[model samples]
Target chain A: MNYSIALKTLVVKEVYRFVRIWPQTLLPPAITTALYFLIFGKLIGGRIGDIHGVTYIDYIVPGVILMSVISHSYSNVVSSFYSTKFQRNIEELLVAPIPNVVILLGYVSGGIIRGLLVGLVVALISLLFTPIVIHNLAITLSVALMTATLFSLAGFINAVLAESFDDISIIPNFVLTPLSYLGGVFYAVDMLPPLWQTISLGNPILYMINAFRFGLTGVTDVDIKLAYLMTGGFIATLTLFSLWLLYKGIGIKN
Target chain B: MKALSIRNLRKTYHNGFEALKGIDLDVEEGDFFALLGPNGAGKSTAIGIISSLVTASSGKVSIFGHDIKADNAKAKSCLGLVPQEVNFNQFETVKGIVYNQAGYYGLPRKLALQRTELCLKQMDLWDKRDTVSRRLSGGMKRRVMIARAMVHAPKLLILDEPTAGVDIEIRRAMWEMMKTVNQQGTTIILTTHYLEEAESLCRNIAIIDQGHIVENTDMASLLARLHIDHFVLDLADPLDSLPVIDGYQLEWVSDKVLNVAVPKEIGLNRLFAQLSARNINVVSLKNKSNRLEQLFLDLIDTKAKGAHA
Candidate 1:
């Protein structure tokens, strides 16, 4: 099998799908992130003053960037893959000779590309409202890539188990959005009540956001090494789970 | 080598519905084979199993010389399936759908592009290449799928009701297209509700009923099994009633027409001699229905009766 050609075609198909519907997939995240910067950064940051020795707007930039990465990555795979199953187009791939791992990696790469692209867009948008600086370039890129892969895999799992359009929406609405909002996209967990702060510590999104924050503003409540470790662990666990689901043909095979 | 081989293939769905019951089949390379069955008789299940769309309970299927279990990729590489329904991305352009399918089969970009163009032209879809599939007519969409499936030029092409719901003219055109494809040394396997289509295109036939292969034989041999043929004969004079022939069954269709079920073993000469003695001049005689259709019905009907017995 020519893995390179197969991977490229899958990735290209994925990218073309979202790009063709730019208004739906690409523009909404940009506009939503811009609104966040305008309202939270300019309208409200003045009163909140500084956070962790930096301007309030600067503090939330990393969180906002991670939020876009997570949302775009997850939604891209969930929507794209679930539609493939729903439409029965996955039969094309199932009958093809491409390896299961290549399918997984190809879709994940698509999610990563969309997630990082949206993340970059949000970051550039943030620059107009706040001066941004990256404390660790390596950490920032890796964390972004890891976060995208993590959610993209989650989306794939959701798609495999999803039987309808409503099933796809349930996860992003009830679980992902709530976890992301409370995951410290706007405020540091340190400012919350001790019990709430403890609960926040348990949220995986917190580790991701804070790790990305450490790379951006050089400030985080948790150890940065633990943050990277959590990212790696999530990738490994999700990769294994996704591959197993594909092998079992869960909700996909007859 | 056989284009396809299936041995003891069986499938019991999760709900315990046995779609196939240990069926075995073989198709010689370059042969046009028809797999015919009633609505729940397991034609789809057999095709699904061979295409790897549905899991079989127990069976061995090999394409060419590659075993599905041992060499899945190589086995799949030799087969192409156009499903009974539309399965392509509805939002993608016709050209894009064909190009991507070629790529999925591991064709490089340049070769994929060339084949995409060739298939589109062959299927008469080149003019609609830029149109998204959702915008095309139902017949056009089906053609796009055919083009997509043939993009890789697989050695074996399997079409399940490829012309179902298509208009007669369009169906004829597709039949012509597939004939050309088959003549190029590609084996063709088809399952269809249209018995006429199968009788017209396929050289060999298999009839499945209640999850069993009731009959499998060459097309000519199967039709030959019809020891009786029914012909509608127009008479120069009005028949007063049904005529009495020793070996032939005759019924008056109208005042001037007679329906005769002629036995193949008994000569039409005998029937003509008997009619002439009765002073009945024959104006014209023609077959009552397609020979294969008669045999297909008789086979399925006999199986139904045997099952009840």
Candidate 2:
């Protein structure tokens, strides 16, 4: 079998699926990021003192962009895959000759693309609020793409386990929303009390947002190497788990 | 060479229901075969297992030469399946559905596009290529699936009730297309409630009842098992009384219609000759019932009776 052609087909279908509905997949994040900048950066940051010698708005810019990446990546895979399962059209892929890893990468690649696209849109909106600065472009791009990959895998797992439409939304609302908010998107982790700071380290999204913040503003509350280690570990674990779920045909095959 | 071969296939669902009871079957290359059964009699389950959509508890299934379990990709490459349900993305256009299926089977974009167009045109769905599948009628949706399945041009194609809701004209057109495909050396396994379709198209047959194969034989041999065939004849002239014929039972249903029970061995030729010997001119003749349907019912009934005994 021609693996390249099959992989290209799935990735193209995945891209086409979201791109065709740009109004829903691409618009909401731009609008939401603009509101965040308006409310948190201008109205709120006007009163707060400088953070790490930078304006409060500039300090939160990287976190806000990474937040969009995390959520968009997660939402893209979860919704696309769950809808395929719910519609029973996943059979088209299942009955094909492609390997399970190709299926996994096809979906994850789509999530990465959307996550980055939405991140770019949010970043463009941020420039209107705060001037762009990059301390380390490599760290910035790596954290953003890795974070997207991590969440995309999570979404695939959630989709496989989901049996109904309601199950798909439950994770985003109950789990993901809380994690994104508590992961230091709007504030610095060091600003918290010591014990609370210790608890914040356990949230994986914290390492990603802080690492991304370091890449942008040269300021971070966590160790940069530790952040990479944690992110890489989570990605590896999730990738293996997702592939195993597919190999077992959990919830897909009878 | 065999197009498909199954050995000791068994499937016991999580709830302790045995959907397949170690069934073994095979179909030769280029043959049109039928797998007939009632609802819940395991036809879909068997099809699912063969397509690798359902995991078997214990069995081996190979398409052409590749084992479905060990050599999944090659096995899948050799097979195409059109499921019993409308399983394609409803939002997709007719062309996109078929075109993407070709891509999934590893056809490059240019070839995929060409094959997609050819398959759609063959299935008579070219005019509706850009229409979203949901907007099409039920029969059109069925044709779209056929086009999608045929796009890959696999060596073996299994269609589960391909004509369930199709109109008669479209169904006949599909049958002719399928016959042409079979003539081109692609094996087809069809499952349908329309027994006449099986009688007309399939060369060999397997009838499954209660998770067991009760009959497996060529179509001619299976139909030959039916000892008697009943025909309703419409006479050109109204008859005052039914004519007596040796070794045949004729019943008068109306002044112009006669129902005759003709044994298979004596055949319909002798009866036609006997009627011509009389002054009776037959206007038209039709089977009292589909012969395959009658035989299917008998096989299921006999299986049930034997289990009780």
Candidate 3:
């Protein structure tokens, strides 16, 4: 329905938004990833030995990249949407003839672009510390894209629920950050006790990181197929929910 | 056919404050219609509903016969809204802002650029096309907004307090440009606190207050309904005492000058008769039209007092 133009423009604008504010949006994540590679991968990897027949550095690479993807995607949507709300320019699009689905896709596509771009940068920088390898290019790309889309939708939802600048940071600080770090980003769920392992499975991000780790190193604590299915389910659910919120004009109308 | 029609539009905030209770209005094709009210008088709410920015609780709005709720896409395509706030993407140039707005309406890049240029030039913003929107002055930013709204060339233009904070010179220019647009067959609907502007430019006006339309009529008829005029009399002789004129309110500001309010039908003939009867020599007399500001204040004050009663 002539969505390609809308998608393309939105993605370009989204990418430009973060790129234009490189110090605030892009640099902090890159520096944080560097620290993770240094303190977690090198200092801790030497003590832990190996995980699933791979060195700790290589094992953590996929998780680090996936973490970057999730944070970047979520932040992109939240900040962009919140800024629009603050500036009130969103009324322009709200008053236009465009379909709600098109607006959803356009904003989501922007988030995806930022998430994937930052993910690529993180992956490339990891090579400086340790050699990287790919087990399945298709699975790797699919998992990364789907995970970005899912988190971007989540960010969109957060932005819609947020009423102020403080509101925008609440979910990321209290919910998203804690969920990502505990969702097996640093270690395999198998390393936990059986009860803890089962509980960790409940975290949606665990499935996404595991699927991505499997794509990169062909090793996973959970079944690779289950990981793929769960991530796909997440993407579908979040997309539908976000579209519903858009149609209802949440946070947009009084 | 009516270019725009609204029926029983109502809006209430979550905090239980009713911004718009119920308003009905109709703007004819090629008409320059103005919606006039004071701050917090529901002018913005009415415009917001018509432009689809604010949803009505229980009402209907249509653009050129298309129901906004049922055929939003078709209805919205026929409308262009210039909001009161200067909200825009600060990072983009003026040209980019206009172009992106057109793209949002599903226009192709080529067509969007063409329309953007045309609109920019029309708003006299062509010289500042490449500058970022943030760097422009307040007036320039307002002009950029007008350009963005006109990019799609909608059949109806809705402006919400377009010149609220602008200077008089810029406001005059904006009014002239708006008149040109109205002349081109794009029905213009604007809301403003400037009563003089509405009196001079609008053929029809609607006065909304407390979510209800208190007054709606042609400009001429509304002015005639006030039925008030003013006379400034210059006397040849110094007045130690004021002369009482029946059926006219008089104030003697100085010995040589006296101001009076008289019904329009009661011309200066009666005033001259009173002066001659009192042996007051008259040097010169001038008549002044009733100022719209007084009428607006009187209407709103009367309405407010009535509500309290």
DockQ (CA atoms), all models: 0.77, 0.79, 0.58
The runs of at least 3 residues in candidate 2 whose Cα sits more than 4 Å from the true structure, single-residue gaps closed, are B235-260, B265-283
Which regions of candidate 3 deviate over 4 angstroms?
A: A1-3, B231-243, B252-258, B269-290, B301-309
Candidate 1, residues B1-309: lDDT per residue as tens digits?
Answer: 899999999999999999999999999999999999889999999998898888889989999978887898999899999999999999999999999988888899999999999999998889999998999999998999889889988999999999999999999999999899999999999998888899999999999988899999999888877889889998998877887889889887798988889999996999999999999999998988778888888889999999899
Interface DockQ of candidate 2:
0.79
Give TM-scores for every candidate, taking all chains together and pairing residue i with residue i: 0.96, 0.95, 0.92
In model 1, pairs of residues that clash are none
lDDT of 3 by residue, B238-266 (tens): 99987788888898889989988987788
- After best superposition, candidate 2 residue B267: deviation in angstroms? 5.7
- Give residue B49's lDDT in candidate 1 (0 to 100): 84
What ranking of all candidate models by lDDT puts the best one first?
2, 1, 3
Ranking by DockQ: 2, 1, 3
Compare the candidates by TM-score and give the number of the best one. Answer: 1
Off by over 4 Å in 1: B233-247, B250-259, B267-284
Worst 10 residues of 3 chain B by lDDT: B285-294
| Per-residue lDDT of candidate 1, residues A1-254 (tens digit) | 67688889999999988888889988888888899999998899879998889888898889999999998999999999999998999999988888889889888888888999899989988888888888999989989999999999999899989999999999999999999999998898889999999999889999999999998889998888888898899899989999999888888887
Q: Per-residue alpha-carbon lDDT of model 2 for A17-64, expressed as tens digits?
A: 989999999999899989999998999998996888878899888988
Which is better, 2 or 3, measured by DockQ?
2
| Model 1 residue A127 lDDT score | 84
lDDT of 3 by residue, A1-254 (tens): 25566556666777777888889877887888988999889998889989989999899999999988998899999989888888888887788887877777878888888899889889878988998889999999999999999889888888887899999898889988888888888898888999998899888888888889999999887777888788788788888888888888888875
